[model samples]
Target: MKHRRSIELQPPAGYAIETERQALATLPQWFVMHARCRACRHQTPIERRDVIRRCGDTLSLATLARRLTCRGCGNRSGNLLLLEKLPRD
Candidate 1:
């Protein structure tokens, strides 16, 4: 009997992972944004409208992560952006 090899499938072209290449304006209204500090592990919810106003609607989430500063530890490096989905009524 011959052993079968597993095949890996790639996503369609123009497909991107969440948070990667995703802009603020593209986020759905039910999804909430959060900022987490890599150093202290502090997480806080961020307002989408406020972020859009300050950073503009075209700014990617990855770029926003780089610009975040930890309010707890005051760390500027390795900050993360998170998304939370809310249940629809």
Candidate 2:
């Protein structure tokens, strides 16, 4: 049977993240990267590794946002949301 899971969104202040690079370094192997274009509101989901490979490991989250382009609108400006998976059962 396939496993199921749910995400618990708590307060951000509960945890301490010193830097963007530091946070990305601790992400799981299979995290989802949510990219959205500000101009056209275009959004896309990409794998963590693919983003890293495309943007390079040395780039920070801010740099990654600037690097990625929207395929739907061909815009360079966008935001990124990093999501991690949690097992429920």
Q: Report the Cα RMSD per candidate.
A: 6.5, 6.5
Best by lDDT: 1
**Candidate 2: stretches off by over 4 Å:** 1-9, 12-19, 28-31, 78-89
**Clashes by residue pair, model 1:** none
- Write the residue-wise lDDT of candidate 2 on 1-89 in tens digits: 22355444553463433335644546554445677777777777767776567656665665566677878877775455445444435
Best model per TM-score: 1
Per-residue CA lDDT of candidate 1, range 18-73, in tens? 67667888876777889999999999999888988887999988889889999998
Which pairs of residues collide in model 2?
A: none
Error of 2 at 59 (Å): 2.5
Q: What is the lDDT of candidate 2?
A: 0.59
TM-scores of the candidates are 0.76, 0.58
TM-score of 2: 0.58
